[model samples]
Target: MIGGFFDRYCGDWSPDEQALFEALLEEQDVDIMAWAIGTQPVPERFAGDMMIKLQRLDYLPIDR
Candidate 1:
């Protein structure tokens, strides 16, 4: 799910965004779900802006 979005839209994001998305992909599913649901903290590095971007996916206008 997230990986598909990354592949579709990551080219428009900065290098750091791309890296952060890849890092998220490498994580365990439970941790990812926790972050997605706000039950666990997202890493401080990708905290504010990046987290917002990822969480906004459902609301975004995805072309693919």
Candidate 2:
């Protein structure tokens, strides 16, 4: 899931978005998954357009 997210969005990300993603990488995998799946509330620091896109999960393959 994370790989799909990175592949789809990382190419055009700004430096700040890149940094935010890097910081997200440091979080627990479960927390990231929860946030992406809308099972957990995203923290204020991580709440924004990027996170909103992540929550959409639209980049994922349809077959999956």
Single out the weakest 10-residue window by summed lDDT for candidate 1.
53-62
Off by over 4 Å in 2: none
lDDT for residue 1 in candidate 2, whole number 0-100: 89
> What shift in Å separates residue 5 of candidate 1 from its native position after superposition?
3.2
Q: Per-residue lDDT of 1-64 in model 1, one digit per residue for the tens?
A: 5665666677788887778777877889888767767889888865877677666667345677
lDDT (Cα) of model 2:
0.95
lDDT for model 1 comes to 0.72
Please report the TM-score between candidate 2 and the true structure.
0.93
lDDT of 2 by residue, 1-64 (tens): 8999999999999999999999999999999999999899999999999999999989988973
Instruction: Tell me the spans in candidate 1 whose CA falls farther than 4 Å from its real position.
Output: 57-64
**lDDT value, residue 45 of candidate 2:** 96
> lDDT for every model?
0.72, 0.95
